[model samples]
Target chain A: MSRNLFDMVWDMHKVATLSTGQDQLFIGLHLVHEVTSPQAFAMLAERGLKVLYPGRTFATVDHIVPTDDRSRPFSDPLAEEMLGAIERNVRAHGIEFFGLDSGNQGIVHIIGPELGLTQPGMTIACGDSHTATHGAFGSIAFGIGTSQVRDVLATQTMALDRPKVRLVRLDGKLGTGVTAKDLILRIMAELGVDGGLGYAYEYGGAAIAALSMEERMTVCNMSVEGGARAGYINPDDTTVEYLRGLPYAPSGEGFEKAAAFWKSLASGPGSSYDDEVGIDASSIEPMVTWGINPGQGIGISGRLPRLEDLEGAERDLAAKAYEHMKFTPGDPVKGRKVDVAFIGSCTNGRISDLRAAAAVAKGRKVARGVRALVVPGSKRVAAQARAEGLDLIFLEAGFEFREAGCSMCLAMNPDKLLGDEVSASSSNRNFIGRQGSPTGRTLLMSPAMVAAAAVSGEVVDVRDFV
Target chain B: MTITPIRSLAAGRGIPIRENDIDTDRIIPARYMKGITFEGLGEFAFHDARFDEAGNPKAHPFDDPRFKGGSILVVNRNFGCGSSREHAPQALEKFGIRAIVGESFAEIFAGNCTVMGLPAVSASGPDVAALQDLIEAKPETEIRVDLEAMRVGAGNLDFGISMKDSYRNALVSGTWDSTAALLSNLDAIRAVASALPYIGGFA
Candidate 1:
């Protein structure tokens, strides 16, 4: 039977169908991290089930690892123990682990593509919501829970019902100053957080094609934020070129053959979709989340929406969002005073995002009492940023340049927000207490916008700073 | 798993908190969230934080002993927000919470509690207020949650809870297998898809 890329890939990875009608998808790649994998690996030990596909699994430590002061004993005893647990688990299982000593360690999502472990047409699973970040390489990647993590480790397969497909087409070009972060925020705002329920999104169209692999990673990383099961782009020269010269990518003639197969995974020209959404790229602006969920967003220049202006579930969410964000309806998101300004996370913490933020902070000083931090998405990115003197620019501008890890992004590490501090953040998710303090507030924006807010001590348009 | 809605009541201040969405981090904190059974987690609830730097519950409500004896916990929406760690609720249950009442709970939080037999009651508007009043008026007040009737009564206050019929039925019937239910209809789904006029290549 004729099939779309998604269908062909799904068939390629299927192990069996359960009585529940969900296909038992055989994971071609499994990624693990310190935070969620310890218990899963322990569970495997308890069950005495060796990993069926050890070669397919790769492990790293990111969350809870201190970005500054890399030493034997960690300040947070719990973080130290968690790291030790991961080390023990991986060692016991005889799996490849990219430890701090390896110099190859970073965020699980970041390291995947940087190391070329994420490849086109592969079914990837990880114990992280941002596992979808790997889908940028034209892979079918999704995050699995801890128990499901165990399933993948033990049998390398998971029982998941096939999601209906949603075709999202964004045509034309993004305006200047618009980035992938804005594109995704715009999509979430248009679709609402739950818009993609029970569906996998095939992101197509000229705008997606125009994005670099890093940019695509930023987009697919937030697929979960849009409630899509997963999101992906088609394999093209960009995908192949990005994978080439990477540490783990097949080399020589083997790579050439793989590239051909990868190119074949593109959706056929006439392929149909269950649900389709067409968006004009011009319609999307540099967007930011004004309220709790990612969907409660508008253009950076736009005003917060009145609750009544929404309909059905949207209205209810708007009301709740207002209550949680403690913001009056119809207020301007710009110029909102911020005590903290963060410009990092897997969402928008890539090297390019760092460059944008540094450019914004150039020759400018941070606002008094405003604490700003610049964390690279990976160790490699961190080294490169230092080589480019991006770190020096940030430091001179009064921002703390820390080593790489998922810092402040979740505060599982030492980096955290004090009570009730309102922060302008480049990281996604402005949910209640998401930044650590129960009453702490977070405003999600682009890295450059965060830099502007850090210097101004309030939300300022990055376009003006530029 | 079957989930029953329970009317959430309000009680605050000096109450021992069985905080909703108590993930392994908050309940046991990351330091002690690992290793042993959840048996000792109750005493360790907010171990690193119960008191605070000054040994007080300034912002954290975990140290409030007033809500300690209350079987029901009133909570904020999306009570379980971060992490898929089930140990959060495990510590709460170990701390002696039998049920949680909130505007809504996280999908993972509710699922974990279901497996552990901890009932999460979802309430709305007025019913939420009545529960609050009842709990505040009597610290040790116990509210019985009736999944079949979808109601909670404490003293003179009565509250109604709503959930999907399938979920309610599952709670009442002691079968909370949503996946099994979906699976049972696979043949029917196939039949319907085949019967559809234009759903080609779907199955």
Candidate 2:
């Protein structure tokens, strides 16, 4: 049988086809973070095993480490211990380590690409689920558990059955002021969170092509929330340009040779898909996740969906979302007050994201009583934003400018929403209690929209601010 | 990776954490949610609330070192939820939790335990409470989960669990490489590779 692009990619990466119908897909690159890796490496140590491919794996600290007080021996004893453990683990194992002290440390996903480590035509896995963000470079990237992490460490391979690939074609064009965050939110709302179960999403069509590399990353970063194991965009010139000269990228003559290979990873002309879902980009408006889960969303101009307006699983989920979010049925999601606004995460914290948010928050002052904070996705992004005076603009507007890390996105770090505070956030997912507060409500939106909300103290459309 | 379903565990008892959708985050808060080793995390299990105002180990009934050897953790539905943090299972395993019974578990959490040689079981509400009562009645009681029959049995209480056959086989073999095993037979693998004739052309 003629193999599909996914099949070809899977077959190309397979070290061995196991008996149970799952292939031991070679992981071209593996990223480990402070929180999940120390223990896995410890398991290896107990067994007196060494990392099979140290050059292929990289390590960094993000979770738990205090973004602000990053000095050694962190006040949180556990944080210090975790960081120390990874430091020792990487050093002893001969794997690359990006220490906070090394200036290369950042969220594993963000720094991977900026440092030119994450590349195209490769299979990547990390302990963190958002690792799919690497797919913007046309790589097949996904998250795995610790044992799987250990498996990848010991053999540079992961075991897996192939998932059905669904081509999500976004044709037409995005209307002005609509961003990639909105594009993903719209996709999630249409598909619901569980829509991609047992599948990988291949984002394509003009809308995705029209997006910048960073923008495409913003789209793929949320695939996990929609229940997909992985998501990717076919590599193109934009991807090649993004990889032209990163620290780890092939140099000079190697670059041209690599581009040709990377370009071949795209679906062939007239390639058929197991499933195809098309969307008119112009129809997707600025979107925000209204209730819990990425699927519970509404357009900027759309009304909050009523429990009755939903049906089946959606209705039940929506009712729960409403009761938890304390939202009224049929109300406009716009203008809902927000106590906090977070403008970072691997999802929407790239340098481009910071620039876009800063554009909206430049002259506008934050609303009284709104505690807005901007967290750069990585130290590199933070340094770039600072170079452009974006950090100053945010600080002048009353938003606390912070260092790089996942921050409030998952509340693994010190920066987290307190008590029952509802936040307007640029990060993905609004699951109940996901934002630190057991009852804290999260409303997800684009970076610019989050900035606008920070200034207005409510969920205001960024177009008006623009 | 290995998945060794419990041959049987001495029934364990403790005060219920009583959280529904007790995500992997709460199972082991994101801060302690690091490291590759499964050992020693049991002490830090539920560390956020396990410690009191002074960071001292609160005398929560379950925090007693006596329950440290407890084998079962009874939880609400949709338990072991949230992001695919494998450390959650590591923490549970480190704490000497031999088995976990919930109404449901997040796909990744359930799979993580299966790959880690641990048993994250699913059971009915009444059955879970009965196990809880046995623990509360005698905190040191050993609860045994019989993987051979897929059931958790204690004094006067027995509850069955359902699992995928692949996962069951993995526990027995101590290797979740069912995919690899299926091909272990030379003839079967030869048949599979031959069926997909185009595979050889790729290399």
Candidate 3:
């Protein structure tokens, strides 16, 4: 019998079934970042344990790094302290460190793929939720908490309960101005935020195959937002070609052998799935989240759902969103004024995202009184953006071309919102106070939509520019 | 590290959060998460909801005088949905939440809770709602969560609750730490890694 990529990879990595009825699975790649690793490292010290496989674990600084200044000491003492903790811990454990000086430093999710550390048919674990971003390469990658991080460090494995599989098949092709971001938002809206609780999503079909590697990453990156522990796309020419000649990828004859193995991991023709959800790709439009969660999104031409249209928990959440966002039910979201426009995160911070934003920002001035910021996902992304002069385009448009880091995505650094400023953001998670200020609001959209919002000083359709 | 067996949580006062989709950002804001450790995070649990910009107390259940010492948290569906921050569970645990009874929970959040020896159990929507109503009607109502029996009791009401069997087993067997159990299979882990093409560099 043929099996899907998830089952194949999961079975290959299963070390043992423990007495507790959980599988003790081996982790092929363990990615670590500053904010979540410090405590895990401390736990290791407290328990007198060392990293089981130092080489398999990679460390980077992202969440608390200051994108504005790469200076030695971050102005925020706590941020500097957190960075110091990771640096010391990595040094002690002999793990590879990607600091600002490494040129590979960016978000952990971005560097993992760009460096070829993320590959097909492997199990990847990270302390960050968006770690599912690695699944674009046909891997079973999921995020874990700090304790699990400690477990991965002390042992090369962690215990996990198996999740059933859901095949999210996207048919047809996306229309102009409709991107992977839009398609994913549409999927999340159709399936409630908690829709994927006990399942891993396998994205397939012609539409998924049509997406570029970066676009596929964007789709998988937000799987956690939909409550899926992990999401993945099967390996094909696009997946393997994206890994070609990368620093960490196998080379020459080894590459040939690895590519063949990866392709074989794809779901076979007769592969079975526990459930299947079909989506019409062409029907999706550029999406913008109207409420506190990513699932509370509507198309660019749509209006906020009236309270009466929603019922039960949905209605209660919508009422809370209206009260928090100061939005009127049935009011059109278009032309809603934005105080800030942010473009960057593991969700939409790839080089393609920057290029798309630059395409809209070129020769277009940001509206007066709008604070626009363009942050790359990684140092390499920033370098690539500079090579293509995307940075110049954004800078000329009155957007702050900042260094690579998480930046304003979660606002762990100095960059944050003031008062009740409304923002148009390309990052995932528009949860309440997600971008910093307790009262600040976030409207999640694609990078181009963010650029359009910045230029027009309000929520505008990106298709208008096209 | 010594492991502690957590069979059940005894009857205690309950805190009812009558909202849905209360994410990690709301449980503990991003600014407070910058610390290197999870220590002192209890004071910041539900910081934004329990306090205003000026730090004044808000009309939140966690802050109510009646539920001051509440050890069981009763919530609506999809609680702890965003950001796989362990700090969310850490904050709640430190804030004295020994068990959580909700209509449902986000996958990662529930797993994180399990690893920390905190049981995140689920019940039918009506059962959860009835429990919350009972707690609110009488703030002094005692709530108990029994992982061994797979049930939750509030005041005069007893209802069936559900959690992953693995989680329940780990809690009862005092192996919730998992690191010891996982490490015991180190040789098998190495054998599996050796068989993987990628791990061997496809050579």
Q: Which candidate has the top score in DockQ?
A: 3
Alpha carbon lDDT of residue A176, candidate 2? 83
The residue-level lDDT of candidate 2 at B197 comes to 20
Candidate 3 residue pairs that clash: none
Q: DockQ of all candidates, in order? A: 0.08, 0.20, 0.89
Q: Model 1 segments beyond 4 Å from truth? A: A307-320, A323-326, B1-203
**Model 3 in CAPRI terms: which quality?**
high
Candidate 2 is graded, for docking, as: incorrect
Off by over 4 Å in 3: B1-3
Q: Kindly give the stretch of ten consecutive residues in candidate 1 chain B with the minimal lDDT sum.
A: B194-203
Model 1 lDDT vs. the true structure? 0.73
Query: Candidate 3 on B70-156: residue-level lDDT in tens?
Result: 998999898999888999999999999888999999988999998998889999999989988998889898888888788887778
Candidate 2 segments exceeding 4 Å error: A19-21, B1-23, B32-81, B91-107, B119-168, B177-203
- C-alpha RMSD between model 3 and the true structure: 0.9
Q: lDDT per residue, candidate 1, B32-88, as tens digits?
A: 444423447676655545555345454544445556555566664456544445566
Per-residue lDDT of candidate 1, residues A198-229 (tens digit): 57888989999999998999888888777675
